[model samples]
Target: MSLARENRIDLVRGLSLLVIFVDHSNLSFSGALQHSRGFCDAAELFVMMAGMSAALAYHPASGAAGFRATASRTLRRSFKLYWIHLLMLAAVVAAVFLLPFIRDPALVREWSLDKLAAQPVRYAVEAIFLRYLPAELDILPLYMLLIAAVPLFFAAIDVAPRLALAASVALWLLAGIFHLNLVDFSQPKGLWYFNPFSWQLVFVCGLLAGLRVRQGQAPFAFSKPLFILAFVFCLVAIPADLVIHLGEYGETTPLRFLISKTSEGPLRLINALAIVYVVFNLDALQRLSPTGWLRPVFAAGRNSLPIFVLGEILSDIVTVSVFGREGIPLALELLAVFVGVAILLGFALHRDRAKRRRSGKPASSLLVASQPEPDYGPETTTEPPSIPDARPNTAT
Candidate 1:
């Protein structure tokens, strides 16, 4: 197999992040893609890809010394995410208070910044602990928690891979069965919107897949019957959710509650895994040439952290300004999304240029090829199975 770094992962990740921003914006006609309409969405894509990326980057460090190296990197990244979350929260707080003073009072009520202002001290502390997430702010803390625990996953896999996976599944089932989850300080009755206990199962699933890939094997066994079953499930799930409105039955259907997003329901996991299977086996999105038109997407994926933060900020702006407002056509809201993506692309380009400058590279090599990545896949005669410890893809 070719050892080149997988551009498809980056490409899919970038698109997923953008899709998330649009989905959160509540703009008209923006729900055409993945999310809400089904059991899966960008978040699933993000977490799974993160797991794969982590395995690719760290699995070689599976033994004693290597484990330390992987743990150190994981810890450094976890801290970085913590700091980044704090900065983003601070910015959101600033926006919450500043927007109304500078522009419109409606924003204060509209964005729900008043409560935060009312108890800044308490909320600030709570926010630090990820107990005061407003909206569009929940995913990062979950990601941070997962990243911190990745070394544990590596250890578990080293001991007995199947047993590790079973443990993850058991935790998810227990969380669902007992309604166990992280509590929200802001709303004591409510739980963390993206329950980490449930979500970790998905992350672990990805970890296993990535480990298998690293070992020069298909992530899952090729089972025609299994593929057909997953395929039928997807076929039925989409129309059930979108057309028949089956998800609405959750309130009435006792068993349906287990499929809820809050608990990271079992159906959601199945749907996401099915989608992932289709994507990997079909090479559905892997066909893009590195130098093709979608290179900006690769760039965005490469710089996902900054792009995600920027997208969240922009989504807030759209929520208050365009969504639910009269005289604002769907096209205009879509235009705003287009503009938001363009800005992200520009930011990525600027960062690329800066890195080149820092390296004292001449102008000729400034435009680095987005492809030609160091291979982290399974072995081949031409190259080693493992890639060197390069700058880690730190985004989740």
Candidate 2:
């Protein structure tokens, strides 16, 4: 299998990071990302892309030694994510407690940290175990669980892709049917906002797609009929959501059974895959990706963990600063997005420079076919799989 790297994933993933910041900021500007216009949002893209990243990084393990090596790397990634979650909380805490500019009482409520006084020990333990997700911090726990499952999932893939996907779909169905999810003290129903069991379907789909790419094949074969169907599905979905008033029922809406984000309703999954297919087939995007203007996007995607953490912290800051304010003007929203994106890109570029310096190479634009990557903490290293990671595709 060819070991070629596709920089498009990085570009798309980086774009998703920016969209995520916009979505979580609670500012009216969040609508600019077209999430309200689509059946799926950046969260789906992020999770599925994460699956692909995992497959690319840790799949195709062979003997015991190779298997252990893959496990070691993924374990480090999961552990790094866990501590990074806590570190983000600590940073938020330092800001809330130490910074005199922070006078809003709602900050504690927003972050769901208000109960630390009543049961500090219990809360701390739950947070450490990734059981108690707070506010926007919920997604990482889902990611950690998925990463931890990579070894077993890859094993299943080695035997047969169908087996791995079938098991994933079964688990998703069971989870949705039985209301299965991890406990989150912050929520009324004691469930994570992004349920791992429900979301694994999308992750597994992405894993399969990544495996295809690893085998030097297209993730999804191109066909006129499939492309037309995906486009029509996307085109009709917006009006469909409006017609059903999908989320209007809040918790008990029957339509929620088909479009629920928490449980990753069937429509959401289909729409997400459809979008991936359509976007991947966009020859224009692929052609333009190598342009010099997209260097920032490449950098941000390559340094995703750090960029994501910083984006979250910045979102919190933006949300807090605008708390209790009158409506945020459009001009102000544009400025916030501009500044936030600039900061995130700057950090990414800084990391790239640091990496180049360490590698003893003249600093240059990355994603020029080859470059060394150093995560914000070297916490995302993925060694190539030595085994037959995936069988060649003849009937994608």
Candidate number with greatest lDDT: 2
* Residue-level lDDT for 191 in candidate 1: 70
- Cα error, residue 16 of model 1, in Å, equals 0.7
Residue pairs with backbone atoms closer than 3 Å in model 1 (clashes): none
- Where does candidate 1 have its weakest 10-residue lDDT segment? 384-393
Q: Could you give the C-alpha RMSD of every candidate to the true structure, in order shown? A: 6.9, 6.9
Whole-model lDDT, model 2: 0.69
Per TM-score, the best of the predicted structures is 2
- The local distance difference test score of each candidate is 0.64, 0.69
Cα lDDT tens digits, model 1, 200-263, are 9988988888777666666666678888887788777776655423234544455356456666
Candidate 2 lDDT, tens digit per residue, 4-63? 446667777778777777776767745434434466667688777777777766764477
Provide the TM-score for each candidate, comma-separated: 0.83, 0.86
